[model samples]
Target: MTRKRQGQQGWGPEHPEQHYLVQPRTVAGGGDVRHVSEYLRASGWRDRSKRGGPLLVESPDRTLRVAYDPHGQPGGWTIHGKATGSTQEWSAHLGRQTPVEIVAGITDTLPLPRSAHAPNVWGPLADGGWHARFEGNSYSATSPDGTAWLQYRQEANGTALWWTGATDTRGNSWTGAFTPTTPLHVVQAFSAQLASPEPVMRPRGRVPHSSKIRTWSVSVTPSQLGAWQQARINAARAATWARNSRRTDRPSTSAPPYANAGSVRTRR
Candidate 1:
């Protein structure tokens, strides 16, 4: 997207969808954590939290850890993992300034195993018809309307930062950044959301990096809420039904288990 200048920062009194906006209360605003955390617990990861400390969870093998500490230096959210009994280790972090929605992109895919095929960060952008620019190890994709963008700098060791952002003609913008090792699910989640054409429901509150007066927001209606919720439920049910049907078609020895753990527990 072209650099939106810091000029007049207000949308006209017309269609709110025509302008870029921030909605913190909506799933677009990073509201996926509670559900994902519950998913993790149900999928055999242990809740390792202690009173008045960072909310903590650990993989069954004790090699992976996710922590949320308000006072954590450089970043308030961190995920660190190490191979059991080996020196190999990697970490991904998101600063407090990072959008909650973007953070959800990283956490939502933690349960499954990684694919043998490397994560193709560009594939989603290409499918979305965004203009892509590539150079040695750096790449970026900008939305057709110049309202959203994704930037990546790849390193063999997966430490380079990748940025995702949105902007409007009003100079209002939002951004979140993470390392290449942030997890493939995060990349997919961010890409899927960016490519979707639906609207986000946001409650009234100040956005993180932009002025509230600069963008437009409307109260969420009951019908809108019910419709969105029903859609979500139906989509999930369809997915489950399809998966079960496929399983029945063949004699399957096994499939990926959530976190590959049989049970979850809290620390004694």
Candidate 2:
């Protein structure tokens, strides 16, 4: 007898690829360029420019591609990818939102785990406060309040069972299990368990009083004050002169004339 992999029992390789196409509520413009650029960069898309055409953004692996037109048809960015299902997944992730909303969405959906990790199966959660890490069939997450772990087990019948466990700051422990149909409930319970009360900090020692201290008073004549001001100016000029002289005396490290003969020097 042979054993089937945990997640591969019911899953098939020819599953329909997920595709998403998000049309902005408004046309792409200068106002949202930064946001779009950031999303593309974070998603591992690089700009591929060509002669006499719009700019193309492609994934490093060449599995995904995107193009944007601020003034052309569609009036927004168009995303496409191979049958890996990432194209639709990214499109759905982008969702139906205005430019600003999409930017916020991108900001929230970050620090995605590697493809081999369980997070790739669980996906990003609604809660953004916790930091998550994965190892093999188990994953752990920690927030300001507490920490939690989720582990997967393969039953004899090829049914996958997930065990959700957590411990709060108050020394309370909770554990539960769920099938694939109700996995979100496990996540919700885990998130609730992680919502421990915030800690309060109190000062430990009495602050020192400001009154009990020795004092000394000195007065400078007008001439002395004038001399001090003149000294400061002279020191500043001397420092500036030293810096300029050091720069002037430094040896030239420029390349030979042939290397940069065609380069133009612009006025400072």
What stretches of model 2 exceed 4 Å from their correct place? 1-30, 42-44, 85-97, 100-111, 114-268
**TM-score per model over all chains:** 0.55, 0.26
Q: Per-residue alpha-carbon lDDT of model 2 for 54-113, expressed as tens digits? A: 656676567555555545643444444355533222331121212332222222122122
lDDT of 1 by residue, 1-268 (tens): 1224322332223322221244321223333344335544544568998988777888767877777765766545677777445334556665444445455445544544444566776776788788999877888888776667788877777558877766543334446566655556547755755554433333444333433222343343344445544544443344335544552221111211121222222211
Q: Which prediction has the highest lDDT against the true structure?
A: 1
**Model 1: CA > 4 A from native:** 1-36, 84-88, 114-118, 144-148, 154-186, 194-196, 206-268
Error of 2 at 215 (Å): 53
Give the clash count for model 1: 3
Taken over the whole model, the C-alpha lDDT of each candidate is 0.52, 0.36
Measured on C-alpha atoms, candidate 2 has an lDDT of 0.36
